[model samples]
Every structure is written in C-alpha cells, then in structure tokens.
Target: MSDSGPTIVLLGAGHAHLGVIDDWLKHGSPPVRTILVEPRDAMQYSGMVPGWMAGEYRDEETRIALAPLVREARIDWRRCRAVGLDPVSREVLLETGERIAFDVCSIAIGGAGRAENLVGRDPRLIDIRPIDGFIERWSEAEDTAPPRRIAVIGGGAGGVELAFGARNSTSQPDVLLIAGEHGLIPGHPAAARRVVERELESQKITVLTGEAQLDDDGALTVGDKAIEPFDAILAAVGSGAPSWPRESGLPVDEDGFIRVGPTQQVEGLPHILAAGDVARRTDVRVRHSGVHAVYAGPVLATNLRRLIAGRSDLATYSPFGKDFYLFNTCRGTSILSYGAFGLKARWLRRLKDWLDRRWIARFSGR
Candidate 1:
C-alpha cells in the first residue's frame, strides 16, 4: 500500500467514532489518508435528542456540523451511504456505487427502528432512530393540524423522553406512550419509572403497557383493546444495524450486532475496527447504548494510529458496572440516577443543560 492510500475509513458518524475524528484533527493526521463515509452532513447528539423534541433545545443546538469538521480534519468526506464491506480487500462500498479503499476501516452506522415489522406501518408512522429522519418526520408531525393523537412505541429511555417531549411540544395534541413491557423505563429504578409515569399522567398523556402492535392503517392495539387512534406514530423501539454487515460475511451476533475485540477491532479481521452501537465488545455484555460509543472514540483513534505505526494494541473497552440515568425532564427538572441511586432538582437540570450546550459548542469550534 502507498503512503497516500486511505489511512482509515470511518463508516458511521456515531458518538465515539466522531470523537476519534476530532482527536485526529487536534493532534495531527496519520501517515495514511483519512476518509469518512456517512450519509448525513451533520451528526445529532443522542443525549440531547429528547431536549430537542421537547422544544427546550433547537435543532442546530444538538448537531455537530460535519462540513466544518471535515474541512478542519482535512479528511475525505464521502457524503454517501455505506452499503457493505469487503473485509478481505478492505474496501467499503456505498449505495451510490462508490467504493472507498482503506488500510483500516471502522463501522459505526448504528441501528434503525423496526418500522416495517410493526402493524399498521403507515407512511405517517415515524421511527425516531437516525437523527436526520427524526427531524424531518417531527417537522411534518408539527405541521399536521389539531387533535393530533400521537403514539410512541417502546418503553425505554428514548421512548419515554420522546413521549414527554412530544406532549410538551404541543397543547392540543394527545401524546400517548405504548410500552410493550410492563412499565415505562423498563430497566430503570422503580422511583424513576414512577416519576416519568406521573409526569406523563399529569400532562394528560396516556400510558399503556402490553403487547401493542400497529397495523397498516396507522391503528394501534394493545392486547385486543383498541386504543385511541393516532394521527402520528413515533417508534423509539430498539434497533439493529443494516443487514449489510451480516451479508458481507463479517461475524455478527444473533441480534445482527457486529462482534469486535476490546481494541475496537473487528474480530477475525485486524484491518477492520468498529465502535458505537454496531460494535459488540466481546468481553463486556453491555447494552447498545450511546455511553459505550462515547468511551470507544479515543481508544479507537489511538489504536488505529498505533496499528499504522506498527505499535501494540492497547487495553479493551469496559463499562462501569452501575446503572446511570439522567432525566432531561420536560418540566425543567433533571433527575439523575446512579445505579440504584437517584437525584432530582431544578438546578440539576440547568447543570445538565449547560454541560450539553458546552459539548455542542466544542463541536462547532467554539
């Protein structure tokens, strides 16, 4: 391979991988060329997405401008979607027929909502997964006229936050959360779930729990109980990566998650690396949350550079064994929890907002 060849090809703009790109620019470029293959011009912060939906944060406030970052990094920004990979050739093929060559490649494309599998999969139903699609769909929902009965599927953090945000965003519309499991915030503590449930109830947003399914006509039902019809449906359900990885012959888990070693390198292929939601760290069976993506960035950057320099790989990635939660409450109250521990107050919300804003500012070169 020539020195001018692509140094590392980053496949996704997920949390940690973007940080790696930032760090690479801060220090210096590696010997090889760097290329970022993503479909969007900006990456949204998943942490502040709830705030954006809630009318507390603006769209621009939550995004990192990819154009500026690409210019500053002096890396090739292929504004295209990565369809699949040839791990043997170290080539990434885009949906647009563009092929990028790389000495090292990383996959961070993340996942999408299982929209098609849901019943009543109407064109009006919105899956708030990838940030780009969410913004566009939410804009449409806002434009839709009065008496908007919106349904949010899934009971996880994203679902509850989105439910709160949607309810807070409108006055005339009815916001409903359809939790597939027993309660809102399934894995969260009892107190946290109660708080969210109480808030949704106080705001007049209906909360339903059961095996809810949507039909093709946008109707939602929970266990033979025909729920109120929804003008807009937002599915915040869990996601898996694009099927391209599994088809590409790369090793993936049963859930379609890419398996990687601790160094963020794809297992069985040293030349390939992965981070963010797509990469499943073998040692730690952590949930596919954005927190892992945040920590994987530096390690990936360092190890990628070291691999280029022929240096040894560093330690593996590990998650803190505590359950951490911070509620970006729509009521201007941020509730924070550490494992079984919990804290709630107005000042906490302000502090959390300040921190989120500061992080966004950094990405914009502030």
Candidate 2:
C-alpha cells in the first residue's frame, strides 16, 4: 500500500524464500514494498528434520524463526494461507477473504504428499511433509508408548530417512518400508540403492519392494500377501502440487506444479514467479529436492528485483551436475550419493551434520 514503490508479494516460507530473505537482509532492501505470506511464523528446515526425528537434534535446532528475519528485513509478514491467486488482477486471495495486490509475486510453497488414494483414511495415517503436523503426531505416538509396527510408504529420501528415524526413535524396531516397486530411491544409482538396502537390513527393518495397498481391514497387502498389521502408517510418497496453482488459472505441469522458465518466472506470466517444490522449471532437468530449491533462491531473488525495476537483465537458474544427497542412517553413519556413486561411512554423517548445522545457523543469525 506504499505509494512510493511497487509491491512484491512472496508466497510460502520455503528454503528458497529463506535465501531470498537472507539476500535482502545482507544487501539493502530493494526499492519495492515486500510482503511475505506464510501459514506459520516458523519453518522447519527439512534437511535437519530427519536428524530431529532420529533424536540427533532438538525441535529448536530444526526450526527457522521467520518472524525476526522478516522484521529485520522490514518486510510485511502475513501469517495466513494463500488459497487462490488472480493473475489477471495481480492479486493473491488469502484464506481470510482479503486480496493483496502485488506488482510482482513469487511462490515457494513446497509440495505435499500424495495420500488421496490410500484406503482407510484412519487417524493413524500421516504424511511426511507438512512436517510440523507429522512431528506433533509422532511426538504424541512416542509419548503414548511407541507403536508395535510402523509402516512407511514410498522409497524416496523422505521415506528412507523417516524409516531410519522411526527405527532409531522407537523402542519397537518393527519398522516396515513399503517402496512400491521403485525400491528405495530409484532415482539414485544402483550402488546407492544397495547401500540403503544393506543399511535397512542391518537395522532389521523390513522392506517390501512391490506394490502395496491398504485393505479394508486396515491391513497392508503387498502382492496378494497380507503383511503384519501396522499400528501407524506414514506416507512419504511423491510430492503433489497444491490445488491452488491450477485452480488460480496459472500454467502448470502435468503434475499440477506451477511451470516456470529458467529465470523462475511463471510460464506466460512475467509478473509472477515460482520456485522450490511448487515449481517445475521447463528449461532444465531439476529434481524436486531441497538442494535445488536452496540453489535457486538467490537467482529467484535477483530476477524478481530486476523484474520489479523494469530491467530486462534477469538471472537464470542452472542446477548442479551432480547433487550431493546425504542420508543419515541414525546409526552414527550416513550415505552420500552423487550421480551413480555413493559412499557410506561415519565421516560422511559428521560432514552432513556440520553442513546442515551451518545452513541453519546462517538463517538463525548464530
């Protein structure tokens, strides 16, 4: 509402947006009125969440205090959810029925787990994303005496990490990982998969590689075989875009993620941009990982400022050739994978812990 400058609206407090805020704080504020709309004042750094679950970190260690950061950056922080977007009118509709106009808008709202198809829909089922809720539930489960059998759906990093965390956190070691044919991080190399499999075996965690379905009796069935009954089910499957992007008339990918160019601009909409898990860049082969989101932050920030200033010179985001993905096994060890090679060792775990701590420290001003 400032007459002196155009308004820049940032949606979601994702990792990429954290970098944007850091950049704004490091340098001076841009010549634009900035507003950050997020559902929570604190964001859990996803990278440290697995460690937190594994009892290696406290809740405060994994949390990023966005309130002080926003205050320091002199940005208006709205603690609300963005239900819809109006590209034509250049406005964002909040859940409270308020529309905030922006000259430029950036979205970094991360993805959510695809859990609609699961049967039962019981209270015991949970998703790994929207991590705060999952942590709360997990804490409650821990306090009420750990479940006898815990089942984690999906084989990706989230699932594997969650499985390991659950195994380490609970007294009961009966953890089942249902990968559904992908067989634990299919995107990684064969060696990485083997390492994970070996670690799972060493941890005494049961893994079902085939397709799994929840039966009417609350039993998990894998290829016509009814495995042990699971007291708690956690879904860490593929990420799905929230319905708001498509419902708001923005161009999106087949998976419903907002489509963006190399500069992270929303397709066909120059005034709007998107990054992190909610965005799919058309110009590059970028995976929906926290690494890519962190890398894209500065680029997104620069491009947004350029667009706001009516400058044609904008930055482009190029993903790294080999992204280093480290998985903490919760046994004082970690597996580091890049492309087709992986290394599993205790030193890697220490390195990962150090890197994660450093990243969090940057945002926490510690």
Candidate 3:
C-alpha cells in the first residue's frame, strides 16, 4: 500500500465483499489504505450453514477467519457496528464510539430478522438468523431435549434446508414449514418445487401454505384455525437490509435495500459502494443467491481500484441468466436447480459437499 493518506472503509464482511477483499489482496491493493469494520472476527459461509444445523458439520466448519485476510491485505480491522455515516465529512461513526475517516466507503452490513415484531415472544425463543447467534442457540438446544414442536416460518431454500436438518439431527421436532405464499420457493421451477415437496412429505415434515401466522402460544394458525403448537420458531421470512443503511441517510429502495449501479457504486454517492444482500440493481433484480455475490466480487474489486486511481469506476455485474442452485436436504440427498432444470441424487449431494468444503477451504486456509 502506498503512503497515501486516503482510506477505504468497508462496513461489513458480506459474501461479495469478502471475495473483493480476497481479490484485492491476491492481486495488489490500491494506494488508498483498506479497513474492514465488522462485528465478528469470522464470517460464516451461508452455503454450508445447513450442514452445521444437521449435525453433519461443526460451527467452525462454516466460518472463515477474517483476521488473516485483513492482515495479509494490510488492512485495519475495526470490530464494531456502523451506526451512521457522514458523507460530506466522509466519516463513519460506529456504535462503539469510534469514528473512522475514509476517502471512500462501502457498506455490506447484511440483512436482519425482525423477531422483535412477533407478539408475546419468549426472550429465549430461538431465531435462526445470524450465524453466530444461531450456533449458540443450537448448542444450547442440543443439550436440552430436542424441540418437541418446531415451526420454521419460511418457504425459501433456507427454511427448507433448516427444517430437514432439524429432522435429521434431532428426535423429529414435529417440524412444520409455514409458507404464507401459494407454495414453497414461489418463483422456482415447478420441477424443483415438486422435488422439495416430495422430500418434505417423505420426511414427515408438515407443509402449511397459502395463509399462516405464528400466534402467541407458538401455534401456527392457518385461516382462523390453530394447526399445532411449537416449542420454538425459526424464521427465514421477511429478510431485508439492516436498519442502519436507511437511518444513515443513504439512498435506499422502498424495501430499505441500498440501490447500486452495475459498477457496485451507490447511485448518488460515487465514493460509497455496496454489494451482497444489501445492494439492489435497478435493471435486473438478481435472485439474492450466493452465486451472484460470488460473481460480483471481481467487479467490485476492480471498480474500487479504478476509483482510487482517479479513473472512472465502471464495471458490469451481470446476473446469472441460469443460476445453478445446489442445496443438501439433511437426508444426505442434494437438490440442484439450473434455470428451469432440476436434478436430485445422492451423488449430487456428495458433489455439493465437496464443493462447499473447497469453497470454505479457500477462505479458511485449510
């Protein structure tokens, strides 16, 4: 790094930003100094996370140590949550009472779960949202009896994966997937949905679709009738950007996600860029899949370099026209979806396990 005074402050270690950090280190860093400000020392790879829940892998297997990467890149690691930003002053104020000055900045603080929105919730009720927090909850729950009645409130891949993982790992918690929508994985191919539906049925996991709500008694209600009582509720629904971005005065979309150009730079703020789940592209609403985040890394890195070199920051980020989605459903069988195509087999599961191990290995330095 040059002895230049300018600095680039990255707010969170989101998936794409981690790849960007790796690329910038593997190649060469810009003259501007780099600093990563995240609340956690390790970043959990969301892809292998389901395996951890299934008891097939440990928590350590899902996380990558960010300290080494930050050191190798000669970047400072600020352990704190960003509360707000002063664009005119070009400084970020953290919740820990420290202010970081930067010539350029990027935000990737990630999404949050609104468990507080639930009515009459137990303070200890597990909300499997953040990796670190969820790991702790899972550990504690493991020591106790397996949850007698568990409701996973979402129909997305995450919810499905978690439901199967719980069933595989525990004494069958009377698992039920409550999807408010018409079906699980609404926009996914019908073939893929059918496969998942069949798997859920085979596992004896209940599927509640159309209309459902989690009442105070931990009961999932469907159209004025209480279906069942749950010992715990794990929500994978209503995921959105952290409240900080909108509160920080950045230009965010109606859903509170930051809007970015193809170059990954914030729409109005040239010096501030965003990627990962928090970023939304106006032209193409890419499925917030890890693949897109992985693919956006190089582009974000190149544009960051260009911005530092007094050149135009222009890099194209194209969404995958045909996303190849691979997920393991706890019974050691894998599901694959590419565009409208679908496939499932034990061999596919092994392949997915290998792929996840390799991907995590890159970051974990195993």
Candidates' TM-scores?
A: 0.93, 0.96, 0.93
Clashing pairs in 3: none
Best by TM-score: 2
Give one digit per residue, the lDDT tens place, for model 2 in 284-337: 778888999998899988988898889988998888673779999998999988
Point out the higher-scoring one by lDDT: 2 or 3: 2
Error of 3 at 351 (Å): 2.0
Work out candidate 3's RMSD over C-alphas.
2.3
Worst 10 residues of 1 by lDDT: 313-322
lDDT of 1 by residue, 1-366 (tens): 424654688887888777787787789778678888888888888788877776787878888888888778778888889988998877788999977777878788888667656544676578877767888878766766633678888788888778877777755468888888666777667777666766677778888888777644446788877786677778877775668899999998887888898788888988788887776878776667776777778788888888777777565676766356677767788777557655677998898888778767767862
Candidate 2 off by > 4 Å: 1-4, 118-120
Error of 3 at 89 (Å): 1.9
Ranking by lDDT: 2, 3, 1
Worst 10 residues of 3 by lDDT: 115-124
Best by lDDT: 2
lDDT of each: 0.77, 0.86, 0.78
The CA-based lDDT of model 1 is what?
0.77
Give the C-alpha lDDT of model 2.
0.86
